[model samples]
Structures are given as C-alpha cells and as structure tokens.
Target: MGMHVNEVCINCDRAVADHTQKYCPNCGQPTPVHRIDWHFLGHELEHSVLHMDRGILYSLKQLMLRPGPLLRDYIEGRRGNQVKPLLLITMMSAAVVLLNRLITGGGFMDEGFSQTEAMGQALPAEALRFIAAYRSVSAWIESHFAAFTLMLLPIEALVFWLVFKRYSRLNYPEWLVVTTLLTVQTFVIWSVLVLVHRWLPQTQVLAGVLGMIYTAASLMQFFQGRPLGSTLWRTILALAIFSLASSAAVVAAVIAVMWIG
Candidate 1:
C-alpha cells in the first residue's frame, strides 16, 4: 500500500508534483510524514512490539525456535521481513551482559579471580600474573564483551568456511552471519543456565554440553540436503577447530600482555 502523501516529501523536502506519489522523485525516500502525532505514535507502538511479522520480539522468537530455517531464509535473500543479524546479536549480547550484572551484583570479576586463585599450582607463574592483570581489567572486558563478540565473529566464521567450503554454497560473509546468530543463541542458552543455577547443580557443565550439542545440531540443520554423516562430522571438526583457535588467541593475548607488563 502507498503512503498518503501530503504537501511535501518530509524526507527529501521536495515538492510533490503528484499528491498520489508514494515516494519523492528527487531522493527516492518514502514520502510518509513521520510526525509526532497520536495516531502515528500509536501505530508505531503497536507495530514495534506486536507486529506478527517483524521486530525484536519476533526475531528472538524465530531465532530461538527455528534458527536454522531463519538463518537459511535470511541468507537466501528473504530478509526483508526479518531483523538484521547484527542488530539481533548486538541486542542479545547487551541483554545477556545486563542480566549477568544484575544477577551477580556486579562482582563477576571477583568471582572470576577467586576461581583462578582456586586453581593454585595448576597455573604457571606467568599465567597467574596474567590472570591478576586480567582481573584488574575484567570489568572493562565485561562491559565491552559485545564488541569482543563482534571481533571474534569473523574468526568463528572462518572456521565454518574452512570446514564446509567443499560442500556448502555459502560465502564467508554469509557464514559470518550464521556464526553471529549461533553465538547469540549460545549466549542466550548460557543466560538461561546462569539464571537457573540455584536449582540446577553443575549448570556450567550442563551449559557447555548443551552448547556443543546445539552447535552440532544447528550446523546439520542449516546445511540441509547434505548427507547427515557428512554434516555431523564436519560440524564436530569445525567446533574443535574453533575451540583450539579461541584457546590459542587467549594464550597469545595473555603472553603479549605479560610481555608488555
């Protein structure tokens, strides 16, 4: 349906020769006057949260319930009615961090340090020193974890690309989008485990196991039409590669920090 054009195109400030024209000829922006009126505000409010086809709530529901199909659809150019992957992941990451802060009373770093200290002689002296430095800067890391996630996404996507390149049709950028969605889903699962830790003993272990399982299952589902055995084995290998890369990155960062210190 075309927008009801008024006197001028609010977006381009161009005079409309045809009042029935839905877009401005000069700039091609939609001609709807997005003014602050009760009717406009009400319409926006209603569609923002309750629209059945799109928005954050709808995205979240789709991601949680049918991630493989949602991602496949988005990757195949059916994305007009869906939330962008980056926006969805960023919002999810922020929500996870905020919820963790509330649940832990902002002492997450302290808890982390205590856990590291409990490791005792298992950690080398240099590693211990690194942990001390990390503890001091842990708050900064936690606050900027969303940015960290974004930075690491390409690496994760690289793992996927390498593992599935021979059989898959997706390019690196599409794989990156898939990785972003997967990462957000993992974080959401972790948030749930953290929220229910009191009732569920060993929730950390459970979360880790569940995360691996979900990753494998999601890979198989997303790579539909491939042989089941091929998908499963490739997913497992990709996950192992990603884990090693992540650990190596951490070790390199710590070594660099210790050297600089």
Candidate 2:
C-alpha cells in the first residue's frame, strides 16, 4: 500500500507533484510530516538503535568486509546508505565507553586499577606523583573518551594526507573523513579487546597491534593496484610519524607544566 501524503509539501509549502510521492520534491522531506507521538518516537528509536538493514550495523559490516572500497565509494559521493562518519565514530565511542565502564565495574580506570586511586602503590615516586597530579585529566579522558579520541583526528588526518598526497586524489578534508571512519573501526576493535581483556589481561597491546594492521590493510585495499609492500611501508611510516609527533607533544606538555610549577 502507498503512504498517504499531504496535498502540499508540509515542509516547503510546495504543491505535491504526486500524491503517491513518498518525499517532497522541493526539500526532500517526507510528504506527510507526522506529529511527534509515542508511535513515532518508538519507530524512530527502533530505527536508530536496532535497524539492521541500513544504519550503524550495516555501516559497520561494510567497514569490516570492504573498508577500502567502502571508503572509496563514500569519498566518491556514494554515501546515501551509510551513517555519517563522525556520527558513527561518536556512537561507536559511546558504545566502547559503556563496555569499558561495565567491565571496570563503573570505575573510571581500567581493569586492575582501583577506583579511588588511578595508580598502584608500587609505582616509582615520580610516576606516582605524575599520576596523582594528572588524576583529574585522566578521569576526564575516561569519561569523554570519544571527544578525547577525536582530539587526535586532526593530526592523524594531517599525517595521512601528507603521506598519501602524491599517491591519491583525496584532499585534506577527505582524509579527515577517511580517518574518522578508520577511527570508528578502531573503536569497534577496542570494544572487542575490552571484552578479551576481561578474559586475558596479558593481551594489553593486542588492540594497538590489530588496529595498525587493520588500518594498513584498509589503506592498501583502498588504493588498489598499488604494490602491497609499498603501501604497507607507507602506512607504517605514517603511523610512526603520528606516534613520534604525539609523544613529543606529550613530553613538551609535561616539560611546560614542570617549568611552570
């Protein structure tokens, strides 16, 4: 059965070209703009949270199965079906944060750390002091994991664009979008690792290792026809650059704080 529509576009006041049209010709709003109600809210909730045909689950599956081609397609203007990259990352980060909280028994710190004290008693004097001094910042990061993770996107995108500028047609903004998608992938992987950590605490570094591999593989596949070895090396180099730059930034921040104090 066809959806009942209004005589005029409820959004744009434009005449409905056809009563059978599902959306307005002028603004693309639904022909019948239903008022907010329990049924409407319930339907919206279902679509946003549990819809599998198209949305987070679908986007995640595509990202996992063919991340390279998916990114390529999205960058090339085929994004009608996928979730917005930033929104996906935000949602994934929220999910990861929730899982981490659940696993940590509602604590801000990770598995082994005490809720009252972020650092252990056996740590060196300097290390313990540093942790104590930055306890608030650490707690903020634990709470706003998504925002904290996104703070690195600009640098990540910058490095990505610089490294692959000559090889790809994508510009800086496009690279940012690509990085956002990859970060969402990272959140998904991190969530899994959080669960795995519950079982085997020894695999602390596995998330980083797997994230790097997935990123490298995605890049290699995205830039098809490039030699895998060359692409892999370049990806590793980009990661190395990001790591060095971020480490330097942290060191500089600490030094500046110490000097100020």
Candidate 3:
C-alpha cells in the first residue's frame, strides 16, 4: 500500500488524512485544500458569500427584482436558497449606520437635537435642564441607531400582523420576516437618498414620499390575492397606527426621563 498522506484541516486545524474523505471528521466541514494565494482567495470568494447565487448579492437582487414573489416563496416554505430575513435586515441596518456616519459624521443626531431644541422651548426650565443632562443618552441612541431600528422590527411586524390577520393566513413570526425584509428595502432607499442629499439638500421630503409609497406597494404585494382597495386601506391604517404608537413611545420616554431627573 502507498504511504498514507495527512493534511491539516483549514477550519478545525486538526489533522485530516484519508484522501478519499470529502469532509473533516472533527468539524464535518468540506475538506478543500486552498492554496495561500490570490487565486485561492478568488476561488473562495466565488464559492462563498460573493457567489452569484445563494448569497447576499443574490438575495438583494431577488429582493429588488421580485420582492413580492421572493417573500411569498419564503413564507410558503421554499426558503432553502434564500438568506435569512433577520440576517439581511441586520446587515443592511449596519451598512446604513456606517454609511450615515461616513457621510454625515453623525447618524440622525443633528436632527434629533434640533427636534429636542424645538421641544425644549415649549417645556419648563426644569424639563429643559433634564433634557440637557440626558443629551449624552440621546447621542448614544443616535450612534447606535441601527440597534434601535432593529428594536422597532417587532412593532412593525405587529402592525402588519394585526392588519392582515383576517386577510392572510400568516402568523406573527412570518409577519416579522416580512417586516424585516421590507425594512431592508427601505434602508437601501434611505442609503441612496443619503448619497443624493449632497446635491439635493431637500431630498428629505422626497424620501418620506418614496418611503410611504414603497411601504404601501410592499403591503399590497404581500397580500397580492386580496382586493386592491382593501389592501390599500389596511396598509394606510397600519401605517397610521404604527406612526402614532412610535411617537407616543418617544414622548413617553422623554417624559419619564424628565420626571426621573
């Protein structure tokens, strides 16, 4: 018999012999020997997340090209080839936060502070003092806006779930997935607007209009089989309810902070 050859597993770093073995015994990962060179890196990239199919790029393409059909497929139990909704949203949120920081040196904090200042004038001196003292907290929230956005995912999911419960058979978690994917799309739109804001400083209004239209369209597409008028009205009501709930929560937080201080 020929001499047995042993090779180190790239992932587990354990000795893996048996040339006939296709996977590492310790980690069960594929045993592909990749050389330490640019070509190997390129090969890995082609097979990994940068692959043309079954990767983030693929998911993003599908989302843009056929979000309704893509989401419908995922919800209807055909999720083998798609990226996880939560992962996509989380990645997109991080990308948004990073892009915002790089472009604006701050992510929404300036607007937050402007709003706070406007509100401060209406509040009592004591409340204003409290707001000033908690300015750092606001900054922290702004800096970590991505996390806060994720926190709103459940509320968004609930809005859709409640509105479409009678009209669709999907449950809350499924709605959560839908909301997450839609939010990812919104983040992409927001990123584009941020890039264009330098030339068109007044794009905020346009962004708002586009966001509303996108949400309405996405909701209608999600409930595609439903009547168009019914879907439109439910989408409007859901959006109104979500906005009110969000505003109330923000006001309540501010009041609680002032009361504590």
Candidate 4:
C-alpha cells in the first residue's frame, strides 16, 4: 500500500496541524509512517548513510566548481548543507585508497624507481642501502596512504596559518578546516586522474601540478578582497614550506630504515 498521512504522529502523538504536512511539527517525524519493507529499508539506509539529497555530492560539486566561496560559506556558519569537513576528507581518502588498489591490484610504485635502481649499481654500499630503504619507505607510504593524508592535515594547516596569519583573521582551527577542504579537493582530483592514468601513464605529474593549481585558485577565491598576486605568492610560500617539511620527514624515515637494516 502507498503511504497514508496520519492525523497524529506515530512517534510523538502530536496532532499534526495540516493534514497535508509531510512531517509532524512537534517532533519532526514523518507524517506517513513507513512499514518495514525492502523499499523502506533501502530509503532509510540511503538517508542515513549517503544523505544524497544535500550532503557529499552537493559539497563536492561546490568545492570543485567554487572552492573559495564554499570554504567561506562553511567557515561563516552556513554549513547545514555540507558534510563535516574532516568526515568528507576521511571518506574521500578511503575511496581513493580503494580505487587505487582496484586499478593497480595493490600498490602502484613509480616506474622510474626501477631505472634509478639500475643506475645506482656503481654507487657505494651505503648509497645502495639508502636507495633500497627509500623504496621500502615509499611502498609503506603508498600502502598506508589514507593515514599519511590525515596525518599531514595538521601540519599543512599550520603552514597555511603561518603564511596567511598576518593577512587573514581566521585562527589556526579555521585554517585546519581550510586545509581539510583543500585535501578533499586534491583527493577528488586524484580519483579522476587515477582512472586516466590507465590510458596515459604520464599524468601522474600532471595530477600534482593540477592539485597545486587548484589549491592556489581556491586561496585566491577565498581571499577575494586581497590582491590576487599577493594571495598567489603566499600560497606558493605555504606549499613550499609544507613540501620541504614532508620531504625532510621521509628522508629521516629512510635513514632510520637504513640504520636498522
């Protein structure tokens, strides 16, 4: 049978003012109580998990089309329409990891690494050990990509905060939110380019370049009143600092592995 409206809400027993109303005014329960059926269960699951009406897809579209305005909207308290930033990042990271595994059958290491290994044949034993340790570290990173992405957010946010602190009024936590959205955008871009990589293997560098460009564009949009050149320069500076820090960490890890081995 089709849904039938009830004069009183089954959940709260509140008298619904309008017979045409879709939900109870008192408790916000649906006026038309659904029976326990496959249709109902599916609808409930979609509403609870995906919330496709105005959650992930909506946020992603806005981020992709107009990240600066979207970030400004959420930071300024117009957030009801968007999923939580951290949750979005976590979900996107998981999806990217899964997609990469599906496409590559496990981990997709750089093809150039093998060539580098061949060229390093004449190097000293210590240098050879370093190269091997670096490869091992890189493989571990690719396998735990999601965890590494999440771990980088705090430091990335710190870099943004330091670079833009004098110009913007947003605090460290707000910068964290900005970085989370940026990371989500990166993940979305990576997801698309990863599929393209099957046909065009050289697009990996393009993905990195596009991610940086999108990030710079996003900051430009987020700080509209500021001079575009100034925002661009600051963004470049922030990215440079973050890249150096991440590279240092990876090198340290590789060195540690060499010593242990």
Candidate 5:
C-alpha cells in the first residue's frame, strides 16, 4: 500500500510547510512520500508485478517438460495461469545466448584446439584446420542468436506441418507453438552444457555430443504416445530432415551475409 503524509504537521512556515523546511521536519530527510500518486498507481502496479511473476514461473515449469500441456492450454485460450510463450521463450534464449558468448570469449581460442604429432605430418595444417573450425563454430552460433531464431522457428512449423500432415491436426499457429516448446528446450541444454564446460574444462567433443543428445531427446519427447517403433522411426527421419533443412537455411544466411558485407 501507499505511504502517507501526516496530518500533525505544525505548518511552521507560511511559504514552506514544516515538512518541507530545511529537511522534512516530518521524516527528517526529504519531503514525505507523496500519498496521492502512490495511492493511484502503487497498488495497481504491485498487483501487476505479482501477476506477471506468477505467469513467468508457470511458463518456465511447463517449458521444461517437452510436449508439455502448457503450450496446448496456452494456445487454446486457457491462459489464466501463464505468460505468453514468445515473451518467456525470448527471455530464456537471450540469457543462454549471452552466457555462451561470455564463455566463448573468455580466452576461448586456446582451450578449443588440439595439437598435432609427428605422424600427423602437418602440424601447421592441423593448427590452421583447428582455427578454421573454431571460427566457423563461433560464427555460426553468433549468427543464429536472435535473427536466426525468429527465422528458423517458422521453418520448424512447416516441417511439423508436413510430418503431421495426415493427422486430425491443428492449424499453423498451433504447430508453431508446439515447435517452439521443443526449440526453447534446446536453449536450456545449451545453457547448462556451456556452463558445465566452462567450469569443468571438458573436451569440446564431449560437450558437443552431450548437447546433441539433449537436443534429440527434447525433440523426441513431443512424439510420445505413438507406437514405440513408429515413434523412433519417425523421430529419426524427421530429425534428419530438420537438420538438413536447418543447415540449408544456415548456409543461406551465411551466403546472404557474405554477399551483403
């Protein structure tokens, strides 16, 4: 609730009320907290802040569980308990992306490459290869940050549309909400793996492999309730196509950047 000025002021000075004299004669530092504006805005703002926080927590919980019921409920107008999907997903993804950049930028070059041996008759060549690989990985990641996410999300919608083409299905926007749940899950994996990699000094290959598995499992989670064999088959095939499609899109992004720059 809002604070108030006291009625007990002496009105010590005609031009300046006792509360506004050298200091707040009422509270001793400044004028007392003005009650009018606070009474008008404070309670409403406080309620809104609490409501938004509750929505965020609910959204996060559902997002962590792939193919979670939240997306369906949210998209279907049962929106009483959660934040909008795009806002919540955007905040999570942005936080992860920032963490990745910080880790990658912290003396990232040396820890990322391997050395060559005598039988590896090209120490110089191998070093160059390592550098190129490292740069490509970083470039690809930074390139994909936000602009790429917004771009690829719709592509995912199209991919799922084709996969579920025959089912008693939802509309394009519904499929998008479904796909976003999976893609947002990837950022969670990326954020965790990157943090662990920074703290533990693991091999990049180990980091990459674990990241891939997490990504795959997150996607597979949505296909639950189908036949086990069929789910596995479709998941694998869909993953393959999605990867190819994503890669092509990434390549296109690279080419376009190169052309423009």
Candidate 6:
C-alpha cells in the first residue's frame, strides 16, 4: 500500500484542518504524493497551484481596495484569477481564527474550563486552575460567536439597502453579498481583537455588534454616494427579520457541528 495526504491537517499553520490525511499534513495548501514514482500530473498540478495563488492575491487586493466590489466582480466575467468566493471567504475566516489562536495563545474551546467554576463546582485549588482559566477564556469566545454574527449582519444589510435605494442599482441580494463578505472580515477582526486584548480591554462582544453597524453603514454609504433612503422604519423592520433568520442559521450551524463532527 501507499500513503497520501488528506485535509485534516496535522501541520500547524496554527489553524486546524477539518479532516485527516495520510501523506500530507497541511490541507489548506497540500502537497501531492507520488507513491509509485509516477511523474505525470506535476506540470498540470503546478499550473493549478500558480493559478490559485494568483487568484487569491487578486481577490485579496480587491478585498482591500473595494470590499464591496470583489464579490460583484467575481460574479461577473472576471473569474479564475480569483479565489472561489465561498471557499476563499471560508478559508480566510478560518485563517483569521487560526491567527487569533496564535495571538490569543490558545483555542477558544479552552474557555470551557472556566465554566466549571461558574457552575458551582469546587475542586483542589492547584489541581486545575490553569486549565480552568484557559477554558474560561475560550468559553467566552465560543459563547459570543453567534451573538456577534446576529447582532451586526442583518441590520447592516438593511442600512445598506436603504442608503443605496436611490441608486436603484443594488438590491437586497447584492447587498447581502457585501454582508456575507463580512464573514471573512469578522474572522479578520477576531485576530485584531487579541492584539487589542494585550494593551486594551478586549471587547469582541461589544465591538462585534458595533462593527456590524459600522460595516453596514459604511457599505450603505458607499452605495448611496449621495443621500439616505426614506424607508428608515421599514428598513429597521426588515433588518429584524433578516437578523432573526441569521440567528436560525447560526443555531443550525452549531447543531450541525455537534451532530456531524
């Protein structure tokens, strides 16, 4: 038999791969294995790698310059030199998570240790104090993830649609893509929060909600370019519905993670 690489990566990019492999360690960018000295596919594989790398860079550059434009451009004829929208977003999100762990110096799950104490449990003082503290920190992050997502996303979308209503060019789904892009941005923000934690109070909880509002406002203003829309009250109601839907999605994600993984 021969060995091969799989995605549940063992190699520490600090980010955990979602699956396991026999030959390769890091799955985010995995190396192909040649078991029987087969020389074929190298050229094709190399081209694939170069193309993907270029696309990622292009996407990143676009993301930095015009966060609102990247998704729309990708949806247009301009593809291949950019990462697939969903995959790029997900991995970037995961990378931010990985980077956050590096900055924070531990996994968010470790925060679970702290919850035990809050539950009215008593234990030897020295036995697990460190673990408890670690877990507490992680648990706090875990608990806030969905709340953070819900608090900002839909309201921002509503704001976006309203601000650009006059332009009449962008619709809700278009606005939604911009909001979706924030998922990756949300990951990016997490990494920053850790660095901010060292010097200032970390307010992932508060900042996340606020950032959602800020992001929504920025996007709406960008599209609006002239003035705000009239249906402020209606937009607010729509935002509530959208946020509720997002909450349901988050709950589903958590349950799916639990049930499947």
Q: Per-residue alpha-carbon lDDT of model 1 for 171-245, expressed as tens digits?
A: 999899888888877877877876875687454456657877887787778877878899989888988888888
What order do candidates take by lDDT, descending? Answer: 4, 2, 1, 3, 5, 6
Give TM per candidate.
0.83, 0.83, 0.79, 0.81, 0.60, 0.47
Model 5: per-residue Cα lDDT at residue 206? 53
Model 4 whole-model lDDT (C-alpha atoms): 0.83
Cα-based lDDT at residue 93, candidate 6: 53
Could you tell me the TM-score of candidate 2?
0.83
Q: Write the per-residue lDDT of candidate 6 for residues 31-120, one digit (tens) a residue.
A: 333343434466544554445446555565556556645555654546656665556555555665565566777654543344566655
Q: State model 3's lDDT.
A: 0.75
lDDT per residue as tens, model 4, 1-261: 424447678888777777578887778898867678899889766765567546678789899998999999989999887889878898888877777778755554554566667776688888788888988998888878778877888999999999998989999999999999998988898788778767866444666678899999999999989999999999999999998998888899999999899
Q: In order, what lDDT does every prediction score?
A: 0.76, 0.77, 0.75, 0.83, 0.58, 0.53
In the range 1-261, model 5's lDDT, one tens digit per residue, is 323444333233223354444555544543433455667577655554345445555456566753435555666687776666677567666766677567765422245344432335456764555445545654666555566677778887777677666642667888787667666666665667668764666433454455446445544554446555654455456556777898786556555554454
Find the candidate with the highest lDDT and give its number. 4
lDDT of 2 by residue, 1-261 (tens): 123347777667888777578787679988766667899999887786568867778899999889999999999999877888889988888877787667745533433335435446767877665555454445766777778778888998999899988877889999999989887877778778778666755333566677888999999989899898888888899888987886666556555554555
Cα error, candidate 6, residue 83 (Å): 2.4
**223, model 1: CA deviation in Å?**
2.1
Backbone clash count, each prediction separately: 0, 0, 0, 0, 0, 15
Segments in model 5 whose C-alpha atoms lie over 4 Å from true places:
1-53, 104-144, 199-225, 255-261
Better of 4 and 5 by lDDT: 4
Please give the RMSD to the true structure for each candidate, in Å. 4.1, 4.1, 4.5, 4.4, 10.7, 12.8
Cα RMSD of predicted structure 4: 4.4
lDDT at residue 128 of model 3 (Cα atoms): 80
